[model samples]
Target: MSKSNPVVIAVGGNSLISEKEKVTVEDQYEAIRGTVRHVADVIEAGRQVCVTHGNGPQVGFILRRSEIARKVAGMHPVPLASCVADTQGAIGWQIQQALSNELRRRGLGATHRGMAVSVVTQVLVDVDDPGFVDPDKFVGEVYQEADLPVLREEYPHWVLKPDRGRGWRRVVPSPKPLEIVELPVIRSLLEQGFNVVAVGGGGVPVVRGDDGELRGVAAVIDKDLATGLLATTLGADLLVVSTSVPKVSLNYGTPDQTDLADVTAQEMRTYLAQGHFPPGSMGPKIAAAIDFLAKGGKEVIITCPDNLKNALESGGGTRITP
Candidate 1:
């Protein structure tokens, strides 16, 4: 068999919280345990692995907690950027701990002892991105039609939008990620044979100031998009996006849905243009895959946690090549 390429895997939020009933911290930790086993498999297979993960649900949990505490115990509401940073640390810690334990259990003791670390990553975005002009990223809790008036009265600064079939939710700008601020440190960690978890929750969104310093922005960057940027920046050979589904599909959720495999970048781009992927779902991921492949990436894999091993070893997932 040929050597596996250096891979960057972007784990989706579903990997942590599959259902609303299992939204507890311990429950999410259990979910990470399963996903990290798959990550450990890749490491044992001799593939250099770097990881990034989403934190939408996790951030909402933190915000909700803060809101509840403020109502009952007189605490200040956390800022949106601060919420992103909080989840990055919390989720990164869980992933590193779980990956380390799995490595040790597999008898890779040396790799387990302080070999995994989480970086509080920051990603720079254009301050004037169109997203800020028309914020549409749904966040936090949903409210019923009856509560709309009360919600509007309570939080007039929030932008409310109906979430399809779901109720109304506060929306925020989801700006595109331009740069990873801690790229050098991440590179150093990877060079030292450590499993590095960086850019959690698409990184705390930031912008460059007039003095050439970074300032946090109240927006959430798409984790997959950020991972694609990281992959291209690091010159990674492959980008693996572990989402909720095992494969990318055409006409998803329909009777005539079709799974795609071994597709070229041009072919995927055609499908993307045809609106096969929606922005709220697979659209950004496909865009990210195309971005990575166009930037000289060898391939991109779209798969779920359960099929990660097969996807890496036997070309099981939807593969997009340049």
Candidate 2:
């Protein structure tokens, strides 16, 4: 892809913070900073970039802090939709500032295709979506056995699930995003020669009320799905989903597992139907890829943050084509 063909780079929020690393705010900034370097590499290689990011971990952090404040200081609890909004602004700012700084450090002047802007995106979801009735998107911190009784007693509305025996965590509905409310604004920003970062944590998951007003809802939208929509809507030829894996695999975690360097969207759909990708992880990404291709997207690159640069240059990751 050339500079004329902008690429939508979707970075996962959980991809920013690793369990092995410190989870402090400063640490989170450093994590994004590291990933920003690779994004700068793409920009330096003469490509316009529109960035989108996930906010699962960061949103959970806000939720945990709100719970603590509400219990200790009698502070009002932040709404779940508000928590998503908070992380969207916070994490979007981190990426925008980090990308700007990285570009500058590379001697790319402020106006040299480095004026990065973040849009506090609002993605619309259907109010009648079944997802709201059976919320399953995970958010917040995991509670140990000792803290379970208190958490359960206090937040009875929460849907807690066991996290592989690690602890119990809250799960919210992950509704499918119907439309991006700020689509026109983002398109305008791109047309004005700015690298836009929008749709953080799947665009603040909102729904339209019967009274014709847009209201925030307590749900998390899939970031990849939103990014795919953005890529299609913006008419970007390339969509890059920088996840935690270097490449997609078939029969993942098994002996017959095989890494895919290049595959067609049709092939990926076949694997998806066979249950090669689970819902909680790579499934959404593959689904996003297929959707993008179906909507006339030229290519999709799926790899970890570190491999993004090489993935574009030498097909270093799974390259899904139409």
Candidate 3:
């Protein structure tokens, strides 16, 4: 694990939400402050960083707000893709500001020629993706089982599913990101020694028209998957996916559960095929790790945000290699 090579860090949406009672904007900002401190450590360690983050919780909050205004004040509801774009700016701004401030505090900012920027990124997705037909990405507030009927009556198009042991929540289509339209800009930022935060909520999902024009679509792209693609596209040496866990596990949450410290892409793919990782949990991360490694990425590290420094030190976290 060389600290000098470029690294793509995919921060999880849950990292922004500390607790159920602390979902306020201020709380999120504070949480981002904590995360970016670790990021600054990575930067100080000599790694050029490009960041991507999940927007599930933030997008859900915006959608809930829009839904409330639509029902109470007769306002138009925001489109799903628009909500994603909104969070990219909102969350990206928070991260950009926090990272910059942290870098400045460590004497790495303007005085030392360090900087950070956030891009309102767009990702290309296949318009005909089957995910649109089956909305699998869970979002928004969870509801009690008793509210299912009322929810169906209010939002007929919403697909409600039980989010593990949590509660029933709205699920949306999470189309695969095919290409990042702003990859050149991101690379340019890295070349300039500026840390970049891009591809929030897997980037505002978009599709190319017959005339090659791009338009936003009503779909969410998985951030890990998009980060993997971004890493490969940028030729990043490492893709560090910061999730809610410190490691990737086999048979997660069962009696025979085992945490993986290191594995090859082929071995992880075999576990993925064996149903060890579920789609809603570690599946996409594993898939992303395999994709990145297969696409010439030197390594992929799946760990929690707090463990990012240790993961880079190879002290912990699941490391996947080609």
Residue-level lDDT of model 3, residues 184-234, one tens digit each, is 888777776788899887898999999999998777888889988998898
lDDT of 3: 0.86
Tell me, by TM-score, which candidate is best.
1
- At residue 36, what lDDT does model 3 achieve? 90
Better of 1 and 2 by lDDT: 1
TM-score versus the correct structure, for each prediction:
0.92, 0.91, 0.89
- Screening candidate 1 with a backbone cut-off below 3 angstroms (N, C-alpha, C), the clashing residue pairs are none
**Candidate 1 lDDT over residue span 1-322, tens digit each:** 2222358999998679867899889999999999988988898887778899999888888888887887799787788999999889999999999998888888785752335789999999999999999999888887788988976776788788899979988899999999999998888788777778999989999999899988898899999899999999998988999999999999899999999989999999999999999988899999999999999999999999989999989989999999
Identify the candidate with maximal lDDT.
1
- As for model 3, its CA RMSD to the true structure in angstroms is 3.5
lDDT of 2 by residue, 1-322 (tens): 1224479999998878866568887888899999999998988998888999988778777888987898799898899889888888888888888889988888885673876899999999988889878877777777787887887787788788888888887888888888999988888777776788899988988888879899998888999999999999889999999988899999888899999998999999999999999998999999999999999999999999999988999879999999
Mark the 10 consecutive residues where model 1 has the least summed lDDT.
1-10
Which lDDT values do the candidates have, in the order given? 0.88, 0.88, 0.86
